[model samples]
Target: MDSIPNQQHAWVNLRRGEPAEALEYRADWPVSKNLEPGEALVKVHAAALNPAGYKLMKFLPNFVANRPLGDQVFGWVRSDHMRLTNQGALCQYAKVREDWIAYAPSNIPLDEVAGFAIVGITAHDMTVKNADLQAGQRIFVNGGSTSVGAIAIQIAKSRGVHVTASASAKNEAFVRRQGADEFVDYTTVSLPEFLWQRAEEGRKFDYIFEMAGVTDPSMYTQSDSYLSPMGFYATVGPQPKGLYLSEIWNLMKTTLFWHLPRVLGGPKAPFKLVCLDYQREDLEQLQRYISEGAVKPIVDSTYNFKDTLQAYERLMNGKIAGKVIVKVNIEDN
Candidate 1:
């Protein structure tokens, strides 16, 4: 390993906007070395992009954002999601709390494992914790091709749950490869109507995992028809791209429906927004799955650290089937 430097290169967010507009690459950025008692400094080899990274960049300003400098990436350090710290993974050095760290699977490389923390744990949270699925039960994942959705499909399938997931027709094969038993071409029909039709045909899901950052509430509001009586609807959250009227209207409707009582016309099924909390056990479980090949890491594309903005562009374009990685330690990759 190379000697740790006082200053290192990083992608810093200047203002809230798209990645291209909000981020600047600075070589003089100081490495965060002041560690709290349990924190460890890691020399990042690679980092992976997630939709939440750009979404936060576009929605929040620098001062209040936990990851003000760049997107969170898993790297040479163990696969754990870092939070409430200035040390983001887009830089060469990141400070991660000891509780968040887990041993990387010996079978995978740094770049591939770099995308594991967020998506993997999120899938585990949705499939194992929130929904509490069981063998022979059925689940519907709204965004099968998404990083989280892909992992969720595999996790559910590994537990013997039947998975029906959605993506564009082009990604049907890709989604199915992740162990989805059924695939829905989301572009072919209105999702709510399609789900209703499925329900009418006697097909109901034990749980619905909305991994897509959908702002529209109709699919969830109308979930009573497709969701089993005791089943629940889980979502990453209602993520709006911007403050457009349509987005705002959907957000408002989502909030209203979320709080509305069933007696007052809310859906009969339960709804929950899956928020990921860092847990050592959860991280270890995911690592175990990786080691067992139950959960596989998929990298959509990779770029040098210099082209991180380009990597973000690919991520925000919304067509990727897997994680977009950036090689931070150029020589190591």
Candidate 2:
């Protein structure tokens, strides 16, 4: 392996406003000869493709003059900020900050570790940080089969919370394996109606993790009925324009009808909005979970480094049940 020439391969965007046709397959971009201080030179074994990758590239023309032109090949969240990097894991080797990298679990295959950090951190933030979930609480997860959803389920379960999750009928079993106590098929079931019925039955959740924002504000408005008094709602998906308008209206309604009672009359209501951010400590905790077999990597598929476009396409198609990883290279170490 030492005798193998040091070479790096990457999928680069050379032109603007083009689809996958704009990507340039290259054998060389840049490679670090040695690790800098607080850095580790890793032989990238795998990389997970997030849906944001395709959305960013497709919308690049709106943000930048050159369209899909940027050195940063991948975007990952670090704390509250989004970090862009040309040095994606879709190469033979990558130099990363040692602080940014978590020790991969020994039990999981090396390829699966690539997809762990981003989603793992997101899940940890939503369940532990934003929701402030306590043991024995009941929570609702809006999307059970997504990469982030899978991690959220495990994290919530580990904290001893009971999780009710929504997914397609086909993915119900898969989500159940991840630890969902109840399953709701969004295809056939009316979520808002179902939640209202549950509320009528004296059922409610302490927290709601909204991962599927496909129905705009309707999902939130409807799910609000299922929340217990003083519950929290954390969202990771983008809300539609109309939904944003609806949210403003709802806020106004709350301020007019509910706020006065809480402030002047000393009445209490249950509703809060939360947006999640990634943290290094979350990654470390998730790594421990993965290592201990409490959580497992759910990889939808693996593609070679050159097939990153295909991986991105797979993510955009909404067919993947879990994370999609790209194999950069195999390493003995």
Model 2 lDDT per residue over 1-333, tens place: 353346667666556533386667788666665556875555555667765455454211100000011121222323221234444445565555555655555676766666767777778778878777789899888888888888899888888899999999999999999999999998998877877777788878787787764434454554546778778566774434344777667545444442344455422433344444545676678778887877887888977766777877787688788887777653321
Residue pairs that clash (backbone atoms under 3 angstroms), model 1: none
Model 2 ranges with Cα > 4 A deviation: 1-6, 17-19, 34-36, 58-85, 222-224, 239-276, 330-333
Report lDDT (CA) for all predictions. Answer: 0.78, 0.65
Q: Please, what is the TM-score per model?
A: 0.88, 0.79
Error of 1 at 262 (Å): 1.2
Judging by lDDT against the true structure, name the best candidate: 1
For candidate 2, which ten residues in a row score worst on lDDT? 61-70
Clashes of each: 0, 2
Q: Cα RMSDs of all predictions?
A: 5.1, 7.3
Query: Global CA lDDT of candidate 1, please?
Result: 0.78
**Candidate 1 lDDT by residue in tens digits, 1-333:** 235678988877778887888888898988877777986666667777767678776211101002223333242233223334544677767776665656667777757887877788889999998877789998999999989999999999889998889999999999989999988899988988887888898888899899888999999999988888899899999888888999999999999998899999999888898987657788788779988988898889988989988998998788798889888784654
